[model samples]
Target: MVKWDEDIYNTPAYPVTDAARYLGIPVVTLRSWLKSRPSADNNDQPALEPLIQRPDPNLPQLSFTNLVEAHVLRIIRATHGVKLDKVRKALDYMSQQFDTAHPLVMKRFQTDGVDLFVDQMDRLVNVSRSGQLAMRETLKHLLTRVEWDEEGIATRFFPLIESVPESEKVIFLDPAIRFGKPVIAGTGIPTASIVSLIDAGDEIEDVADEFDCTPAQVRAAIQFEAQNRAA
Candidate 1:
C-alpha cells in the first residue's frame, strides 16, 4: 500500500537497467530512445532531457517522452481500472517528472508491444490484486516450463511461495474451513480435494478453473500425495 511520488516520473533516479526490468524492456531499447532528440515545435520548446549516463557511443538522439508515455498507457490498460491517480503515481516514480501535465504527445503506438507489456505486468500484479481470476492452468504451464538458472534442469513446478506447511496442513483439511476443504494450511480447503478433482478426469486446468488456486498448486498437492505414498 505504499503510494509512489508524482514527480520524477521518467528521470533516471534508479539505474536504467533496473528501470528496464521494471518496465520489462531491454536496457538497450531504453537507452536508444533516451539518446534521440525530440522534434522541434513551432514555439521552440526545449527537447526532452537525456538520461545522463557515462557517455556511451551507442546512444541515439531521440525523444524520451514517447518511451515513457508508451509504458504508462501499457501499464494502465493492463491493470484494468488503473486509477488515473495510480497511473500518475507510477509515472512520477518512473519518469521523475514533477509536473503532472506534460505537453509531450505520442504520435504512434504498437498494439502488439502493448500486449506483451500486459503479459509482464500481469506477472507482477495479478497475484496481489486478482489472484482468484488468474488461471491455474496458466500457472501450472509456467511452473512446468520454468528453467532453473543453476543446473539448467526443468524440475516439477510447486507453489512453494504459497504452500501450506504440514503443521498447518491439517487446518486446511478441516471441513469447516474454506467451504469445507480449501487446504489453506491455517484456513479452509484441503489441498488434496483440489488434486482429487484433477485425478477425477478433470484437467488440472479444469480443476483450478473452479478452485481458488493455480494449476501449479493443484499439482503440488498431487506431488505431496505421491511423496506420502512412497514413504
Candidate 2:
C-alpha cells in the first residue's frame, strides 16, 4: 500500500487547480488520473488504474511526488505519443521492482527504471532509437526539478511553470514560501497575484513594475493562470 502523510511539511498540498497549472496539465485530467470516478452507466466496468498513488487517498489535491509523476508522464505522452494505460503499466512494473509507491521520485528511476520504462513503452509504441534517447533525456529533465534529502528521497519540488521548460525556468513552487504556491524564482510574489492585476485590466508592464518583475515574467504569470483556469 502507498504511504500517507498529512503533515504539510512532508507532502505537497497544492490544490488540484494549482497543481494542474504548475504541471501544465488540465485539472480534470489530473483528477481523472489520481482517482477513478465511475461513470453513471458502467457500474461493472473495470476500474482504471491510476498512474501514481497520491500521499493521501482522501484529499483531492496532489502531493509533490504526484506532481513529478505527472510531469514526466506529460512529456512522454506528448513527445512520444505513448498511451496512459501503457504508462500505468510501466509505473506498476517500476513500483513492484523498486518496492516503493513513488518510483519517479526515487534515484532508481534515473538509473534502471528509465531503461525499463522505455523498453515497455517501446513494445507498445515502437519508439525509435532517437526517441529512446529523447525519453532518457526527458527523465533527466524531470529529475532536475526535484530537491532530495541526503537519503536520496525526493522531498521538495521546484515546479517548472507550464510556460517554462525545466531547462529554462524562471518560476518555481517552493512549499515553504507562499504555502507552496508558484512564484517568481527569487521573489515570493505569487504568480496568481500578479495575474490578478492583469485580469483586472492593468497593463503587463505596469503589473511587472508593481511586482518588481520583468514584463516577460508578468506575461508568464498571466499565461500560467490563463492556461490553468482554461483547463
Number of the top lDDT candidate = 2
Q: List per-prediction Cα lDDT, in the order shown.
A: 0.38, 0.73
RMSD of 1: 18.6
Residue 44 C-alpha lDDT in model 2: 90
Weakest lDDT window of 10 consecutive positions for candidate 1: 103-112
**Runs in model 1 with CA error above 4 Å?**
1-182, 185-187
- Summarize candidate 1's per-residue lDDT along 1-231 as a digit string, tens digits: 221121122222334553343344456756654553553443375554433221233433211223344344433434354433333334333333323233112111122222333344455455343432343223222233122223221211112222544222222222123422225342234666766776788888887668766666666666655444343
Model 2 C-alpha lDDT per residue in residues 1-231, reported as the tens digit of each score: 333344443474868777777777776777777775453347798775567567667776677667767777777776677777677778778788888767777766767778888887788678899989998888776767766665566655665556565576667665567777778866789988997888799998888889898987887777777766776
* Model 1 TM-score relative to the real fold: 0.23
TM-score each candidate: 0.23, 0.75
Residue 3 miss distance in model 1 (angstroms): 44
